[model samples]
Structures are given as structure tokens and as C-alpha cells.
Target: MSDKHSPDEKDPHDPQGMRGGLTNYGDTDFSLFLRKAFIKGAGYTDDALARPVIGITNTGSAYNPCHGNAPQLLEALKRGILLAGGLPMEFPTISIHESFSQPTSMFMRNLMSMDTEEMIRAQPMDAVVLIGGCDKTVPAQLMGAASAGIPAIQLVTGSMVTGAHRGERVGACTDCRRYWGKFRAGEVTADEIVEVNDRLVPSVGTCAVMGTASTMACVAEAMGMTMPGGASPPAVSSDRMRVAEQAGAQVVEMARRRLTIDQVL
Candidate 1:
């Protein structure tokens, strides 16, 4: 019996790392050849490319303070993926901050969801981590992930720390509304309100209270879309970074197990 095989013969050991979803260039071999050639330009060795690929959505934006910790989260996630024997690939998607978007962030949620779904399908990844912190962003990512039908997980940006105002621990946006009401009733001076403004958001993160962002975080956790205790870590805390790392490592395992999103949802 001959042990030799033709180059065109499918390799039984080929996992869906860089081998999945070949571009329709009318030739499978050429598609893979060109894909590897282009990816190699990014300094990825063939060995690194052989590992399961984990896609991560980067929704960090300068206009979105809620996701300001995205860069740190990205680094932690990559570290975890590498340690777990997977390749992490971060890609940008549409970001919608509630306070910054015109006509409201809700209007843009579907657009972001579509972007997430299409990107996951277009990219070559065995599993994906949806990194988002905004109110609409979490749901948008999940909606897209469900549609994409791959192994998907959600990693929230976490909440903000409480700030102090006049010896009282306060933060947005309940406190913000309280102060505005006080100013309207002549209980607070312009200078006092100005001071309160700085204290409402002492750090860059989502609302400290259980507002939309935090609510959605809990929702994802409850729906089994996120790791255990993935809901309440503050953005600046080391715990959040640990959660990010753990989520990264878990997603790689999910990829290896072929845990599709359909199984979860």
C-alpha cells in the first residue's frame, strides 16, 4: 500500500484554524496560499498560524469612554489565548456610545450587530470573543454571535468605580440626575454642579450603578454567554483583567471542543 498522497488531497489533520472559510478565488489551494502569504506579512509563523484562531472584537473608541479599558483588555486576552495555545486576532467594529451617538445609540445597535455578524463570517476563526461595554454593544454582539453560529463568548468592559462628591460616594448616572434636580430647585449653585460633574465620572468606564450597560452584562452572564463572575468587576480593577484573560483561555478551549453558539443559545 502507498503511504504517499497528492498535494490536492485534503489533509485529515487540518483543523479549522487558517483552513476554514477559504475566499472564493476559484481555487482552494491558491486561496489558502494567498491567505497564508498575506498573513505571514504580519509576522505570524506557520506554527503560530497552525493553532486555533480566536477572533476578538475591538469596540474601543475615543468617543466611547465606557470602553476606555479596551486596550488593556485586549492585551490580557491575547496573553491568555497565547498561553492556551491559540492565536488571537483582534478586529475593529462599529462602536456606539449612548451619550455620543446622534439619534441615540439604540438606532445604531442593529448596524453594529450586522457588522459583528458579517465580520465573524468573513474572518477565519474557530471561536470568538465579543468585547463590549456599552448598553447596546453587549446585546448587539450577542445577536450577531447567535446569527454567526460559531463558538462565541462575551467579555464586558466592566463598570466604573464610584466617585466622591461632598464626602458622599456617587457616580453616574443616578447621581448625575440627582445633582441636576438639585440645581434646578436652587439647592445647588452653578459652581457646585460644575464640581459634581467632575466627581460623577472619576474614571473612564461604564455607569457605576446597574444602568443599561451593567444590566446587559448581567443578562449575558445569566444567559451563559459569559464566564462565571464575568458581570461585576470594575473597569480599573485587576479582577476585570483576570476575567478577560480567563475568557480568552476559555474561548480557545471552546474552539477546540467545537462548541458552537447554537449549542449555547
Candidate 2:
């Protein structure tokens, strides 16, 4: 096998490397100069370039309705970062929504982890705010950050709005499954099940109930990975944007403190 595919060839899967294959921008003098020059070409002034770099992990897609607000969230995060005297750079990574993935979302979580870790390491950012929602994205990001060992914070996309059916309130897969189960047991008619399905996910965001998405959000808080009260806000709420902004500002503080992921984890 070629060195590129060789397992002993410095682990293509590893996110920290001098050559910047996947992690740590290839340190070649030419690559370094090219990267800086290209970034400069984007109209980034020297003053802005000199500031601490804050990376935003954007995992948005039509398939992942959970991150439907990714564009707005990222913009808010950038605004906060720049306002706090940090340079913001948004980057893409795998976006896995539980309902959209094949077999299971778990199967792809590790792949997302690899992508996130390598991307974070490859860039020159002093810190990163992981923007994710849904059942698996946050966990995958945490795994990546744990491996990358950089200063990192998590910002959830927030929960979906509650839906109603025939004057009955409902939200997310838990209630979704419950209603469906009732239909399968002949307790609810087919038309009723269809109506319930439409009402279950009334808007774009993560599950409204304290399901996996909410659970992971809480887990992040419990593990001290998120700001206080970061886990419970509704996705479309202004509070969610405030959380994003706070996340951006906090990353700047983290950069100043030189608090690596090891410290936070």
C-alpha cells in the first residue's frame, strides 16, 4: 500500500500532523504563505488577521432539518466573536440527522468525529464553537474535540416548537412513536396517525421533548461543556441567538486564557 493508505503512515485519521494532511495546516513554508495570502485576498485586514481566530463548525443541510437555522446561528456567532475582538471563520463538517441517515446515525458519528477533529486541527483557530443539533451531532463533536484537545465550546441549535393535533399538544419522536404505536395497535385510525405525524414536527429544529437531542444538550451542560442554561432554549428563540453570541465571546476568552480542551474536558 502507498504511504497515504498505510496505517503506520502517521495515521491519516489523526488530526495533528505537521504536513496538514487532515489536521494542522501543512506546515510547509509555501503552504503557510499561500494560506495567509489567500485569506488576505478575502479582504481580511492585517489587524483582523492579527486577532485570535475563532472557528465555527457549521453542519447544515436540507436533509438535516434540525440545523435549519444554521445560517442565522453562524452569523450571530460571528457577530459576537468579532464584537469581542476575535476573528471568526466558519467551516463545514458532516451533518447527520437521525431521521435521514441510513441504518443508524451512530454508524456515521465516528466519521463526523474524524471530520471535525481534523478540520479543527488543520486550521489556525485559537478556539472553536461547535454548532450542532439532533441526536448524534453534539456527541460526535465532543468526541472530536476530546481527541483534538483544543479549547472548545458547544452551542446547540436549540429545540423545535411544540405542535398540536386536534387540540392535543405533541412534539418530536417520542410522541411521534407513541402515537404511531397506538395506530399500529388499532387504537388510532390511519388518518389520525397521518394527522399526528404532520403535527409532531411543526417547525424546523431539534426534537421538542427531552429526547436524545434534549438529553445530549443536558449532558453537555452536566459535563460542563456548555454555558449555564444553554441546553433548554427553543431553537427559534432570540435566546438561542444570545447563546450563540455568548459562545462566540466565550471562545475568545478561552483563547486568552489559553485553556485547551484538556482543561475544559
Candidate 3:
């Protein structure tokens, strides 16, 4: 694709051409004045504020380290949206960490879906990028976006790094349980078990196993909800940031193309 844009660059899909739907905002001068005055209160200027709007769904929580990179990802996404000629706005939804919720996170997945659907419905976004990690958050977001039938894309928080112990590579929960079982069976000492626990989850990210979190990541990719190969990036890698940026740019394209979620799903 050509990266350069001439002075006469135009989006064929843009309904109002290069100037956008400014005239549709108002046919009369008084109506235009009221609209501009109200929007200006949000720190918008006539020159910099006519771009399409992109919404970002943030589902981070202190309880969910799988999303530890969320704030950084959001900033990167916003930068990409701005660079791609769109206005990025982020909003929060209920974060459901599998380990933290009671009665199973599965039970509350619908609640998160409802929250996401309602927020997207009430918002003025032309397109949205749903950011999530953990076990159930991604699914809930997908369900809600499907129901809302808007232009939406998904970005996962990425995978966790592998843990290590005395020249042995380990990870979370899976190995955690394995070693704990050994300890319970009197096959390993208490000190060894403690050491295993310390070595597991040495980095900030999701479960380092093919658990629900990883499974959901794979499902998101297989369903074509996310960019190809996005599901496997290590959470702390700089590549994850690039993925976030691309997500922002892609949302703008989706909005311009009017490719709503209903069309994709």
C-alpha cells in the first residue's frame, strides 16, 4: 500500500468527502454554532476535531495481571488512531479475572457482556477496539460486540513469559499444581515447593500454560476476531505494543468502510 498521501487525498467511502460530515451536523449557521460550542468544551478545536471517532474498551484491573500492560497498550492504540486520522476514546468495563471471581468467572461472563454492549450502544464511537485478557474477558467482549452489531475489533493483552527454576523452564497454574501435587505426595520438600512457587510467574502476564486464557486467545484468532498471530505475543514484548497500534489504525479503516461487526460475525 502507498504510504504517501497527496494534498488531494480523498476517502471514497467518506460520505462528506475530505471535509467530512460537517455540513450534515447543521444546515443552518445557528445549529452549527451550538454544536461547535458544546463540543469545544471537550477541548476540541475546529481544525483538529472533525475526524472519525474510535472507541477503546479497557478491561484492566489490579486483580488481573494478564492485563498489566493495558495502560501502555491503550496509549499506543491512541497514538495509532491519531496518526491514522481518527479520534480515540477509551472507556472501562467490568474486569473479570478468573482467579478472583466467585461462583466461577463463567457465571459472570454474561454480566460483562451486557456491560460492554450497553456502553457501546450509548457511546458515539464510529468503531471500537475491544481490549481484554484473562480467561473470560475476551469472550464476553466478543459476545457483547456481536450483539451490538457495530464495527469492532479485538486486541488481547498477550501471553505470559515462561518461568524458570534451576535450569528448568516452568510456568503457572499447571506446573504450580503439578509441583504442589508432588509436595502433597511427599515427593518434594516444602522448601522445593516454595522455590517452585517463587520461580513460576516470574514476569507480569497471563497464565503461562494452555489454560483457559491461552485457549481463549487461540479461539479469538481462529474466529478472525483479532489480527493474525496477535494471540501469541508475549505480554511484555514490544510487538504487543505494535499490535495495539495496528488495532487502532484498523478500527479507523473499519469505520470508514462501514464494516460493522454484524457483517464480520
Best of the candidates, lDDT: 1
Measured with C-alpha atoms, the lDDT of residue 115 in candidate 1 is 100
Tell me the lDDT of model 1 at 102: 93
Q: Where is model 1 poorest over a 10-residue stretch in terms of lDDT?
A: 6-15
Model 1 C-alpha RMSD to native: 2.8
**lDDT per residue as tens, model 1, 1-265:** 8764532244734538887888999977788889989999999887788788999999999999999999999999999999999999999999888889999999999999999999999999999999998689999999999999999999999999999988999989899999999999999999999999999998978899978888999999999999999999999999999999999899999999999988987
Better of 1 and 2 by lDDT: 1
**Model 3, 144: alpha-carbon shift in Å?**
0.4
C-alpha lDDT of residue 204 in model 1: 77
Q: Model 1 — TM-score against the truth?
A: 0.94
lDDT of each residue in 1-265, candidate 2, tens digit only: 4433322143533322122332235555555447657878889765676667788899999999899999989988998898898989889999999888998999999999999999987777778899998768999999998898778999999999999888888998889889988998999998888878789998889999877899999999888888789999888999998998888888898977878878876
Per-structure clash totals for the candidates: 0, 4, 0
Residue 182 C-alpha lDDT in model 3? 90
**Reference-based TM-score of each model:** 0.94, 0.87, 0.84
In candidate 2, stretches whose alpha carbon ends up further than 4 angstroms from where it belongs are 1-31
lDDT of 3 by residue, 187-240 (tens): 999889888888888776788798988898889888878878889888899998
